[model samples]
Every structure is written in structure tokens, then in C-alpha cells.
Target chain A: MTTQQLTQQIRIKKSFLCIGLDVDLTKIPQHLLELEDPIFEFNKAIIDATHDLCISYKPNTAFYEAYGIKGWQSLQKTINYINEKYPEIFTIADAKRGDIGNTSTMYAKAFFQDLNFDSVTVAPYMGKDSVEPFLAFNDKHTIMLALTSNEGAFDFQTLQTNGTRGEAELSGAKELYKQVLETSKTWKNAQNLMYVVGATKAEYFTEIRKIVPDSFLLVPGVGAQGGSLSEVCKYGMNTNIGLLINSSRGIIYASNGTDFAEKAREEALKMQQEMQQILK
Target chain B: MTTQQLTQQIRIKKSFLCIGLDVDLTKIPQHLLELEDPIFEFNKAIIDATHDLCISYKPNTAFYEAYGIKGWQSLQKTINYINEKYPEIFTIADAKRGDIGNTSTMYAKAFFQDLNFDSVTVAPYMGKDSVEPFLAFNDKHTIMLALTSNEGAFDFQTLQTNGTRGEAELSGAKELYKQVLETSKTWKNAQNLMYVVGATKAEYFTEIRKIVPDSFLLVPGVGAQGGSLSEVCKYGMNTNIGLLINSSRGIIYASNGTDFAEKAREEALKMQQEMQQILK
Candidate 1:
């Protein structure tokens, strides 16, 4: 989906919420386990229950991959379902994948061509060539990791780097995440770039806005990770409302009873209502 | 496999040569396409032909992930074949995956537990918590990317960072990759940690050795990417011959004809002989 289409969906839904379909079979309702593909069944229910409450759905690949071949099949089914049922809604494959140039193309094909996700998250540690392959796909998006929500985010993302200067001249040092953002903009077809900046670091959003004001940011640390939606929206929202606040465990696992899907919708509804108020 | 076990295998084989199984369908012989599982068939042939010449097999996940379900099946079968048939050989899942703490555990489980790889490559951008989970597994190694063998590596990995000195200590600034190596050593299961230092950067290995002298370095770029074997061995090798030098396309795709497996063995044999001489 294009930026204009995503922006329109946010306005229509009155929520830039992206529900993370991080389905864990063990965590779902006990009754679902009896099904052939419990993961897909659970995701189908959640998507059906909460599709209207959010503009996007993100399925973190790790959750599916943990189950092996069965997991990959579930992922394929989930993506196919989303594309067929709600093609208007943006889909993000939260697969933090990156490699050398040629290998990265295969990954791009996997997520964008094969799986048909509108966007896929990518790690920036390998730099330009690693990310450029994903960006090369027209109309598809590459969400590069910036300041993540985890405790480990501070380990290297925030470290001060001398910004292409020699070792001796670290006078105007920028944090590594900022350097990543700045350097990435100069790559080929960088206009297709988006970013993954955790909602937990809402304060960083103001600074991040100065660097790439127009690019969309997929914020993950909102619900279970304890990031406040209001604070994130307050600082991160651009003219086009270029912020996708993601809530994974908080919404999906709201209740593990037979009414699991219904309860998930309730949680999603609360967030959407809050977003409606914020949009006003 | 434990580090000691891996070390012993290197000595026993007199070759730390790791063949990367990055199988692209188009690149493989057309005849294999007629088979039910061409990728698995191709990988089985390569593994059968070249097992004696190499100490380890590193199958990059991207090549498998591209083909969707069938690709994933191939990957599972290939790993199973290696573990059951060549139990002595170390296995590396070149899936450079990393995420937040809890999510990272799932990825660790995906590669280590579910897929049952002896070692898996992880990107270190997310820091300690993201990596420490992978380390939590017994007898499994977490190979973190230190310096990659690509043009993009220069874009971020080599940037001068003021060593955690509150952005003021510009005088003693170190490159980002070195800081990664230093920081990773302090994590919980430091003993289980290895590193990915590209063979293209042979000169950087001397500096890397100072920080991680004992830890194994899984060096790629030796064959297809134009990195030297002797230079990497000379500077990167430790007392335990701590290097798993990888050659993917250079060996596996040596010839796409019917004699592909035999040609691949010949190529691997040449590298193994070179490594054997280096051991002398």
C-alpha cells in the first residue's frame, strides 16, 4: 500500500493502531489447541473480531518460526487471509531480516512477493546494501529499526558516534540510531523507507521528527511493553499522522476463555476509542 | 555443539572450512527441478559429496525462506540430514535474527530448539538482552556480527564511536564493531558466544582478536566475496584454530551441471587442503 492509502485508512478508522498478530499457541485459549492449525485459527478469530478497530496488522515472524514448518504454513495462511479479506488494511511482516545485498533480495521476495506483506521490518546494523534491496521494491515499505523499546536498545542504538568523522573528531557526535536514519536517507530509493521507533521512547520522537519528518514510524512498545499511546501520539504524529502504534500481547491475549476473540475486540475497541478522542 | 567439541572437530578434520548451503532454485541444475523436493535433494547431494572436506555446514535462512513452505521443508530436511548423518560436523544457521527480550527467546528456540542447529548467527544491534536469550541455551553458540564482508559494512560498522564516555571522550574513540565485541563479552553466557567477522576485513581481525581471543569467529567472504584464507587464518586463528571460514557460492555453485556435487566437492577439497596446510 502507498503512503496516501495508509494515511487514508488511518483517517477512516480514526485509529492508526496496528494490531500485532504475534500468536503463541500455548498462550491462546486451551480449546483452540485441538484444531489442526491452532495458530491460524486463533489469528483468524482475532482478525475477524478486531479488523475494523485497527488500520494495520503485524505478525512477528519469530512467533511463527518457533513452530518450524507448521509455523511457516500458519504464517502463509494468515497473510493470505489478510490479503484476500482486507486488502485495504496495511500488513506488516515484523521480520527483522537483513543480509548482504544479493541475499537480502531473496528476503524481499519472501516477504513482499511470496507472503505479500505490504511492509517488512529490517535491521540496519548491516547498513545501506542490506536495506536497499527491500527499498527497491516499488510500493512496498522497509521499516528499519531505530530506537527499539527493549532494555537492549540502549546498548548500541543510543551510543554517540562521530558521524563519518575521523576517530579524532567526535565533537558533533550523533547517537547511532540517528546516524542510521541519516545515512539511510542517502541510499537508492530511500523514499520507500519507514522506521521502527519504539513508543516507549516518546521523548526521542521529537528529535527523530527533525531528521525524517515525513517518513512513517511503526511504534511497538505501546501496550504490553508499557508505552503510553497519548505521549507517543503527542510527539510522534506528523501532518499525515505518520505513526502506527502497535499493541501485541495487550490486545490479543486479553482473555484466554471461549470469548477470547470477543475480549480481544473489547481491548482493541478501548484503544480505538482512545485514539478517536485523540484524533479529535 | 560445545566450543570444545567444535574445536576438536576442527583439529580432527584439519579444516575449519564451513560450506554455506545458500541454494537458489534458478542457480541450481535444472534437472533437480523435476524432483519433488529439489532444494533438499540438491542440499543432500552437496552435503554427501562435501561432508569430509568441511568441519561445518552453514545454510543461510534467506535462501530457504524465499520458496515459502517448500523452502522451509527443505531447510528442515537439510538440517536433519546433517545432524543424523554427519553428527560430528558443526551446524550454523546463518539466520541473522534478533528482537526484544521475550521475542528473542522464540527466535533462539526457532533455530536452536525447533530446528536444532548447533549455532545461529544473530545481529547485535539490539544489545545484551536480545542476545543473552540465545546464549541461555546449552551447547548452542550465538555468532554475532562484528564486521561483515560487504560494502555496506563500512557505512555503519566502522564508524568511530566515543566509547560510552558521555559523548565527550572523542580522543579514545573506537570503531562501533569493536565496542560490540567488548560489550557482548560481559553478557550472561559469554562462553557460548562466537562472532561473525568477515574475511574481507582481515586487518580488522588483529584488533578483534585482542577483545575476543578465545571465542570462535565464523568468517564468511572467503570465496565468493574475494577474501583470502591465509590472511584470515594468520590474524584471526586462535590456539584452537578458532575460525569457521565459510564459502557459499564459490563451492556450492562451482558448477550447475550434472557433475555439480562432484565439482562442489573438488572446490571444498581445495579449500580444505589449504586449511590443512595452514594447520601445519
Candidate 2:
């Protein structure tokens, strides 16, 4: 889907929420285990129950990959079901992939061509060539990691840069995350770029918006991760509402019982309602 | 495999050469396509012909994942063949995975427990929590990307840091890669850790060795990417010969004709011979 379609979906649904379908089997209802493809069944019910409540579904591939081929099949089924049932809904393969040139191209093929996700989260550690291949696909988005909402964000990200005056002059001796945002914009087909800026750092949004004011930001870490939606929107929102706030466990695993889907919708409704108010 | 077992293998084989099994169908022989599992057959042939020549096998997961579930199956088969038949060989799943704390644990289980890779490459962009879960797995290795061999390495890996006087004091206002090298050493199970220091940046290894001289380094970009093996060994080698220098396409796709496996063996033998001389 194009950015216009995604923007339209957000408007029509009155929500900018991206429900993360990062399902874990051990956490799901015990009864769902009896199904032939329990993961898919669980996801199917979740999408069925809550598809209208959100604009995007982000499946962190690690959850599906942990189960091996069976998990991949479930992921395939889940995405296929979503595309066929609701093509307007944007999809993200939260597979933080980045590799050398040719290798990165294969990954681009896997997520963009093979799986058909609207976007895939990519690590910027590998630089331009690692990312440019993904961006080469004009329609698919490449959400690069900026300020990750984790304790480790302080490790290398928050560290000030050691660039020479020539390098530092462009972006100042700012944090590494800011540098990633600045440098990425100059790459080929960068118009297709988005960013994964963890919502936990709501304050950083004010600074982030300055770097790429127009690009979409996929904000993870909403409910379970302790990011306030109001603060995120207060600083991060653009004229286009340039954010896709993601909620995973708090929404998908709202309940593990037979009524899990309904309960999930309840949780999603709460988010969608909050989002609608924010949009208004 | 433990570091001790890895050391034993390097010593036993008299070669620190690591063959990267980054197989792609287009690159492999057309004759192999007729087989039920051409990838596995190609890998099996390569392994059978060259197992004794190298100490480790690193199958980049992208090449498998690009083919979808069938590709994942081929990957499973490839790893199983090596583990069952050539138990001494260290296997590196060049999957470059890292996520949030909980999600990272799932990745650790996927690569270390489910897939049973002895080591898996991880991106350090997410910080400590994303990596510690992988480290928590006793005996398994987490090879973090320190300084990659690709052009993208220049983007972030080479950036000088804006460390405080205190941090700069510890590791100096070092480049991002050195900071990664220094910070990773402070993580739990640092002993089980390794770094992916690309051979193309062999000059950086001299600086890298100063941070953590003892930790093993998985150096890619050997042949196909124009990295000199001798230069990597000169600067990076430790008393334990602590470098798994990877040569993927140069060895694996040595030929696409009837003698593909033989040619692959020849390429492997050439590297092994060079490695043996270096060890001597």
C-alpha cells in the first residue's frame, strides 16, 4: 500500500494504531493448541476481531521464526489472510534485517517480494548500501531504527559522535540516532523511508521531528512498554499525523480465554478510541 | 559449541577457515535444480567434499529465508547435516538478529535452542538488553557486528563517539566500532561473546584487538568481497588463533558446472592450505 492509502486507512478508521501480531504460543489460550495451525488461528481471530480497530498489523518475525517452518507457515497464512480480507490495512514484517549489499537484497526479496509486507524494520548499523536496496522497492517502506525504547538505547545510540568537525558540522555532535535519521534521508529512494523511534522516549520526538518532519515514524512501546500515547502524539504528530503507534501484548494477548479475540478488540477499541481523540 | 571446542577444531583442522554457505539457486548449478531438495543436496555435496578442510560453516540465513519455508527447511537440513556428521565444525547462523529484551530471548531460543546453531550474529543497535539474552545462553556465542566489511560500515561503525570525558577516558573518543568492542566486554557472559570484524577493515583489527584481545572474531569479506586473508590473520590472530575468516561465494560458488562440488572443494582446500601455512 502507498503512503496515501495508509494515510487514508488511518483517517477512515479514526486510528493510527498498528497492532503488533507478535504472537507467542506459550502465552496464547491453552485451547487454541488443538487447532492444526494454532498460531494462524489465533492471529486469524485477532485480525477478524480487531481488523477494523487499527490501520496496520506488525508481526515481529522472531515470534514466528522461533517455531521454525511451522511458525513461518502460520505467519504466511496470517499475512495472506489479512491481505485478502483487508488489503487496505498496512502490514509490517518487524524483521529488523540489514546485511551487506547482495545479502540485503535477498532480505528485501523475502519480506517485500515473498511475504508482501508493506514495510520491514531495518537496522541502520550497516549503512547506505545495506538500506538502499530495501528502499529501492518504491512502494515498500524501510523503517530504520532510530531511538529504540530499551535500556540499551543508551549504549551506542545516545552516545555523542566522534566525527570530525566536517562530519559533525552537518548534524552537530548530536546523538547517534539523530545521525542515522539525517544520513538516511540522503540515500536513494529515501522518500520510501520511515523510522522506528521507540515511544518510551517521548521527549526525543520533539528533536526527531526536526530531522525528518515529513517521514512516518513507527512508534513501538506503547502499553506494556510504558509509553504514553498523549506525550508521543503531543510532540511527534505532524500535519499528516506521521506516526504508527504499535501495541503488541497489551492488545493481542488481552485475554487468553475463548473470548480472547473479543477481549483483544476491547483493548484495541480503547487504543483506537484514544487515537481517534488524539487525531481529533 | 564452547570456545574450547572451537579452539580444538581450529587446532585439529589446522585451519581457521570458515566457509560461508550463503547459497542462492541462481548462483548454484542448474543440474542440482532437478533434485527434490537442491539446496540441501548442494550443501551436502559441498560439506561432504570439504568438511575436513575447514573448521566452521556459516550459512547466512537470508539465502535460506529468501526462499521462504522451503528455504528454511533447507537451512534446517544443512545445519543438521553438519552437526550430525561433522560435529566438530563450528556453525554460525549469520542471522544478525537483535530485538527488545523479551523478543530477543525468543530469537536466542530460535537460533541457539531450536535451530541449535553454536553461534549467531546479532546487531548491537538495540543495546545491552537485546544482546544479553543471547549471551545468557551458556556455551552459545553471540557474534556482534563491530566493524563490518561493507561500504555501510563507514556510515555508523566509523563515526567517532561523543563519549563523556569518563567514557572517552576508558575507551577514548573511539570510533563506534571500538565503543561496541569496549561496551560488549562489560556485558554478562562476555566470555561467550565474539565480534564480527570484517576482513576488509583488517587495519581496524589492530585497534580492535586492544579492546578485547582474547575474544574470537568472526571476519567475513574474505575472498568474494576482496579481503586479504593474510592481512586479517596478521593483525587479528591471538594465541588461540582466534579468527574464523569467512569466504562464502569464493568457495561455495567456485563453479556452476558439473564439477561444482569439486571446484568448491578445491577452493576450500586452497583456503585451508593458506590457513595451514598461517597456523604453522
Question: Taking the candidates in order, what DockQ does each have?
Answer: 0.78, 0.70
Per-residue lDDT, model 1, residue B163, is 68
Which whole-number lDDT from 0 to 100 does residue B167 have in model 2?
45
Candidate 2 fnat reads: 0.82
Could you give the interface RMSD of each candidate, to one decimal?
A: 1.3, 2.1
Worst 10 residues of 1 chain A by lDDT: A163-172
lDDT of 2 at A76: 90
Q: Roughly what TM-score does model 1 have, to 2 decimal places?
A: 0.98
B1-280, model 2: which lDDT tens digit per residue? 7777788888888989889999999999999999999999999999999999998999999999999999999999999999999988889999999999999999998998888999999999988999999999988999999989998888888887866532444445778888888898899988889999888877878888888899999998888788999999999999988899888899888899989999999999999999889999
**Candidate 1: lDDT over CA atoms?**
0.92
User: Candidate 2 chain B — worst ten consecutive residues by lDDT sum?
Assistant: B163-172
C-alpha RMSD between model 1 and the true structure: 1.6
Q: Write the per-residue lDDT of candidate 1 for residues B19-96, one digit (tens) a residue.
A: 999999999999999999999999999999999889999999999999999999999999999999999989999999
lDDT of 1 by residue, A160-235 (tens): 8866543434326799999898888899999999999998888999999999999999999997888999999999
Each model's backbone clash number: 0, 5
Top candidate when judged by DockQ against the true structure: 1
